[model samples]
Target: MKKIKPLFLLLILNTISYAQGCSDAGICSVGNSFSNEIQESKNGIELGSIFGKGEADVISISSYITYTRNFSERFSLSGKVTYSQASGEFGTRGQFGDAYAIGNYKFKKMTNKQWSSLFGFKFPFSSANLKINGYPIPLDYQASLGTFDAIVGITFNYKKWDFNSALQLPIINNNKNSYFKEYSGTDDFPSTNLFERKPDVLFRSNYTLKTTNQKFTFRPNLLFIYHLGEDSYKNIFGNRERISGSEGLTINGNLITSYSINSKSSIELSLATPFVVRTIRPDGLTRSITAGFTYKRSF
Candidate 1:
């Protein structure tokens, strides 16, 4: 009983520390130290759902499948495909979402710490075809923006703590109908513009605690994100228009729990919510919950 006291206290504090930040990390940032959890797995598969509600009484739900493969001792590759649906005060939309690929390389290693860099690309796969009463809706309900994005990230791990940061930049312009094209009459709103891509920077840190028996683990995380600029677009009248107050900062807290089902598999539950918002975001998620399971087997 005496030996379990410290461990029990840590468990209690971890549960209260709370997780995931902004749209950038979502549930993926919760308790994901990356160094051991991902590198140790030869091949792994994960299926999960993300559900959130935010401004304008909007609710966003997405389902995703992620696969990871370790090609070498220090190199790994992963991919994710998602389907998302959203509805609420604005409108409703359902479609396949962006697909992304990630590659990681570990360049430094020590007895208890590791450092790695990751690069990835996100491919646009969904169409922005949301309508209301046969009229085009706003951009808030679309599942995808149809832009190709490149991501670069770095991660560091020490013991049970992890730190990671990533930058996401859109490399290709979205040319699809990602704009407000419908109004009562074309003459009334003839200058609607299509949004341009913007950049996102995200940072997250987390600590994990494992039960003495090692069957369960608890993790708490803090996250921050900054938007570099507001989205811009060309209006129907050929004028450049910028979405004001789009650039801002977000802070979030996250908590995650994982239970080992066996030596090769585990189930995870995660929660993420924003604690601060410092901008005019007309389209953003404020809170989300995720439940998923992961399975790993040697190849």
Candidate 2:
């Protein structure tokens, strides 16, 4: 349709505006418009897949299933579980990443503007200590971060624009990886043994466009993720050392297109790439480009 022209223009403009970002670790993907879709519906489910290339020439694939139930107009809850795999010349490793639960609440006092808050928790599957050929592989090859994380965010929507801010904080770290000791020097892996990650802060802005029929929707977003502190790792001597250059910011531009297949079903696609990056990304979250597909069903 003629309206599609603006969607492409928005995508181009979004990429140009950054001129410069993420490597995302599970923040921007949640709480779209504070999950208003799930809020409006009584119940829903989603299945999705995301394909990405990470550091050290590793390729990653993630599949997830989500279910949401609405308790009322002001509150809703959703739960998700994911399975992820990473493979490359180093080797292949696959496992469950984490289980996530998100709770969304809308503000009743905000009559003129839509404001919502989100809180969630991430439960890990196991210690991120996958081995290959008797040697420990780097974070890029592990499916899970091996940390229990707490996520809290707030969203604001006004007309055609949306804004969000969130934080992903590690509450408990059980990462037992020792890849650096075995592969850092010999295999040219980044030296991040026993990886301990810091919390991340996120800021996202987007503009949404829809066709007259509302069957088609396009959203272009710019996401910023900031590593809050210097990450630490255990060295050869068993002494903890700070990984300098680990604390920095990454910016990414993303575009999402969605189509409605009747009322209860829809398909969505998204593409994202970074414009700027930090010198180091030890959390195994770097992605040069990412593409994803998702299908949703409402009940």
Candidate 3:
């Protein structure tokens, strides 16, 4: 029994969701978000799934688990993992995504307002063997970027409203990708090459309204994402190819609700839709819905 324990734990970790990026699950940051109403929370866990549907019959399902620990009155740390599977007319794929560690600090406080800052790091700790029909998948479809990134942000809270802004930037290049390929004159060419990706900047805000009994609450949120630049691909011939229509802005709106089962647990549901798209996005998500259950225990 003891010898099997390590393998059993590894299997469980492999199945854990490694969710990343900003899809329909509100604004996904690198840490335990600082927008929670219960500021006194010492420990918490969140588990959820999100379903996304897009054009060309494309569909995505993602699962996630997050753990948070607060060591002091004004500081906290969080960790999360995700797994996802996506399918469309092209093909299907399932793999682990990314992992994150975040630290948050409350820097200022006032009568009805508070300010906080956050910084974190995301590790591309997943297997890079993701494929579709035995062929390498594109960056948009792959489960992991195979690179490390840094996350930084700030938050402002006033009354029942919370505003958050964050930046995600890749600090390293992925040179181990063997997926990029181009067609030659009459045959297909394959190469294990490097990939260059742009940074993502996001701004999100939400307003919450609760019932008198505080058992039911409703929240509406808006998220905006801006891609900084165009992504590049290096072919086997050492020539760089610019991927067109890859950089743009996306705006999404979400309607969220929560029902408290008790003080220690709650159930939440949400629906998100794209409000505005500034560029031609290929395989972009048009709508998504998410359901989550949360358990919180203060120590």
* C-alpha root-mean-square deviation, each candidate: 5.2, 3.0, 10.6
What TM-scores do the predictions have?
Answer: 0.80, 0.90, 0.78
lDDT of 2 by residue, 1-299 (tens): 57667756666564433322243346767746274433356998999988877665678898889998888888888898888898988788888888889989987635446888999998888788877788788787777888888999998877678789999999999999887735345544566677889999999888888888999898878888888988989988899999888898888778888999988899998877676777777777776446789999888
lDDT of 1 by residue, 1-299 (tens): 36445544554454344222255222243223255554455887777776655444556777777787888778888888877787875457778877878888886578888888888887867545455666664445566666677888888889888899888878886635534434334221122245665788888887888888999877767778887887666666778787677788877666566788887777776655567665555334343332233443333
Q: Rank candidates, lDDT, best first.
A: 2, 1, 3
- The 10 consecutive residues of candidate 3 with the worst lDDT sum are 183-192
Clashing pairs in 3: 17-81, 17-82, 17-83, 18-82, 18-83, 19-82
| Cα TM-score of candidate 2 | 0.90
The 0-to-1 C-alpha lDDT of every candidate, in the order given, reads: 0.63, 0.78, 0.62
* Candidate 1 off by > 4 Å: 1-21, 24-33, 38-41, 89-91, 175-192, 286-299
Q: Quick one: best lDDT, which candidate?
A: 2
Best by TM-score: 2
Residue pairs with clashing backbones, model 2: 20-275, 20-276, 21-251, 21-274, 21-275, 21-276
TM-score for candidate 1, residues paired by index: 0.80
- Model 3 lDDT on a 0 to 1 scale: 0.62
